[model samples]
Target chain A: MSSVTTTPVPRPATVARPTGRTAPVLRQLLLLALAVVVVAPFAWMVTTSLKDYADVYRPPYLWPQEFHVGNYGRAWDAAPFAGYYVNSLIMTGGILVGHVMLDTLAAYAFARLRFPLRNTLFLVLVATMLVPQFVTVLPAYDLVIRLGWYDSYAALIVPRMADVFGIVVLRAFMASIPAELDDAARLDGAGPWRSLWSVTLPLCRPALATVGMFSFLYAWNDFLWPLLVTSDDTHRTIQLGLSTFSSKYGTYPELLMAGTVTAAVPALVIFLFLQRAFIRGVASTGLK
Target chain B: MLAPTLVVIGVFVVYPIVGTGYLSLTSWDGFSEIKKWVGLGNYTRLFRDPAFLNSLWVTVLYGAGVCVAGVVSGLGIAVLLNGAFRGRGVYRAVFFLPVVTSSIAAATVWRYVFGDTGVLDAVLRFLHLPAPNWLGDPSLALVSLVLLTAWKSLGLNVVLYLTALQTLPADVYEAAAVDGASRWQQLRRITVPLLAPMTFFVVIEGLITSFQSFDLVYALTGGGPLGGTETLGFLTYREAFRLSHFGYGAAVAYTAFALVLGVTLIQWRLGGRERWSS
Candidate 1:
């Protein structure tokens, strides 16, 4: 059940291949071409975001003769994008802080602490992962409305504060640490809480980073839940804001591209910085 | 320590699921206090609803399209990048970029790319080809949606394939090579069969993702061009949120849940069979 291991398997010596000079070059060129194909739309996005309205509708829409960075500003002003940004940041921050703290404690208990029905409880938590988020959306919406959390930060944050995937990933990482550390901590007069904060946590930095990155990405980019709960701009997120913006200004590719680019920047920047953890962590978990 | 986590899950996840089940059995307009007992009426109407039936068919098409294309292309790219090479990390990151980007952003970019005089149309025009209305055509709209989904998901598929590819024992390939198997033959006979588990995993993952696909349809097509892209997930959104038919929406959502569960069970059995066959 501990499926979050990231260790690379040892490869046999026979796997090494003798390649001709042209073969490697060909492979590089081929992969490079494919990469261009993948990156071309993104490149188009950034360039189009800078183009004037006429250039966007122009034939062979490759390059812009002049750059209009004002599109970003106009797009920003065209909607309550600043409010959306603030709401998104606050929502993501709340979800991240609460989610990580709660999941860390739960995972620590599951991985280390001995308790009654621990296995049963952990299995119950893991089974929740199979229940698609949408399966609960209708009822969850009702629940939020009943609690009067709709169109508020509480609606956005509280429900998302507990994720089984985070717990599972963190638990697997914590379990892989040698149990001798806990005993050593006990010899030094440290309790479970002290040991968790001072010993186990320091060693689980990579896993924590991985979990944190995932939480950030999910909260930041989430569209459906936010859309369902927040009916107004006050609690609306960037993803929702961008959708509304696209619908209103459907014909304005320049402004639309600008808005989309603005919405995408935070996630892209975060991924740029933490991609090592992001990709590797995703590879390890593979379940989600 | 587990109290907070358990409470949140119990209230948010577990309770809502049970609540969704109960709500599916009653007809409740979202605002009304009175809940009318429908007793499978929504399910009956759902089966007879042409809109619901169309969405079901569209979802299957989109899921199958994304799964097949994503798996094949992802495997091809992963095999290409499997060899030790310069700048492998950069390539991997480039490929995985879309997987991390917001779905709305990806869909928006694709909406433009698929629009008339967009990037794809420009390219096709340059090559002296007619650019069909990719987004406005009833048949082509869903195809465009499928392509958009495939692009967004290609990265995950590649990464999954790469992870599986790395774990394959080189000794099997060595044995195949010793038996005078050609490079392509070695890949066909050894690499592919060994990666079947990942393929199955990816297929199931793809189906689930596609089945719940909403943001793409919402942003890309808006379930438009004659409702060609109205996936079950989108239909659920419309019935419940837009129309305020809470009960019917829950029924649609439950049907989706059942489909996903059914697929998983089938995959589980097939996986067991694969293990036995191996």
Candidate 2:
């Protein structure tokens, strides 16, 4: 009865009942196998990070014979990774902060405030999503240079704040909030800012979180722009810092794997905590 | 309210796009004062440039391979998860892990997995089976990168499909069950037809994302043993950054943009009501 209750479909009284329990069992088993395929690479990545060069070459076996705990340390010493991590943290924080603040305000205005050319502006924003980042990078690079921001954190964070994706996402979530709330807030003598802060902002948490999570991930993993802007080691991010292993120590698989593992952990941790936001971001954005 | 957004987009997104288009028709090395106008020269050179041509071919192959393989595998996994199950949440999370992992980091791990003395070869040797260099051969390298790309991107597809499946009303399945239709028959008749909209959306999104494929090549092959793995994304970077040919790079970027826009437009026109993901 419990199993029957949990089943997705209710069998109609007129239906001829077939053996359904075994079918679910088989499906579950198949899913488990597929899950293993999806997860094996990450498992290998971690296992190999602790692996010695010899054990790595002996790859039929995934578990290391002895944990070389020092690989992380060695990898850390091999490059200025500490500096890179700090820079990455700052860069990710700066970009996401701008994205969340600017996008939420814009989305609120679009959703509730009266303005001329609003619909046209929204359409232009939607169209911007279709343009690839490569097309914009060249001119943005020119702008950054003219502003004398090359090799600075602003180079990584500033232009990225103009996020059409975030604007659309925020607008979508804001539109779903009933206009009646804004009207009621206005009747209660709340200005647009007050209503946004008290009613709308509270409601927009999930959507804001979604945009924050994605743009943070985008800033964290960005490679090319960082490489283009920085001529020196001053403002290096984790992704750009990762190149030392390839350029200087290509022979050291252990170090490369360890550095990759180190570089990946923060993003993974963020994703784990923000998994729901990430899924909602992908799902609602797509379905819309 | 709109002043800030307009200013930012005008300065960054809108102006940048126009500038890029104009830059594609000129010659500039990114740092110099001189930008010589050369209309259609860059586009003509793109076709004649064997390296660029090879990359276009490679990108088309990679994009198609990843789309087909990723969608099929993702739908299969999603279907499996849709059945009554224990630990479904855990399974779903486990599957989605790769989509969050950095592309560069994922490619770096795959390099070892597919490299000469890497994981696959060792496993094959232990089992006394053949292990061809997965990333060595030009053709195989393209295939290998496609495999990695699909693996990295599959989680998004699965999650999307799962959401779509969940939103499907349960009564249809119940009705089918009452009629004694076989599970596969119900899937074919009801599920596939109903899922068409979701399928169309996923494919368009997938194709758009695939056109931006560059990080994998940068991390794994660097466009490879004899330009075998050079992709349009990589070519764009190489033209502007490596060679300092900003104008040419802008042109390569435009070509990619047009290619993506054309295919998307065609798919929009012809793919309406077609059996896309199937």
Top candidate on lDDT is: 1
Off by over 4 Å in 1: A1-23, A187-189, B272-278
Error of 2 at B160 (Å): 1.0
| Worst-scoring 10-residue span by lDDT in model 1 chain A | A14-23
Model 2, stretches more than 4 Å misplaced? A1-23, B169-180, B271-278
Instruction: State the lDDT of candidate 1 residue by residue for A50-149, as single tens digits.
Output: 9989888785466787999999999999999999999999999999998789999999999999999999999998888887777889888888999999
Q: Please list the C-alpha lDDT of all candidates, in the order they appear.
A: 0.88, 0.82
> Which lDDT value does model 1 have at B174?
86
Worst 10 residues of 2 chain A by lDDT: A14-23
Docking class of 2: medium
lDDT of 2 by residue, A142-217 (tens): 9999999999988888777768788888887889989999899999999999999999999998888888888888
lDDT, candidate 2, B165-265, per-residue tens = 87789999999999999989988888777877667767776677667777888888888867778888888888898899999999999999999898878
Report how far residue A183 has shifted in candidate 2, in Å: 2.4
DockQ of each: 0.60, 0.51
The pairs that clash in candidate 1 are none
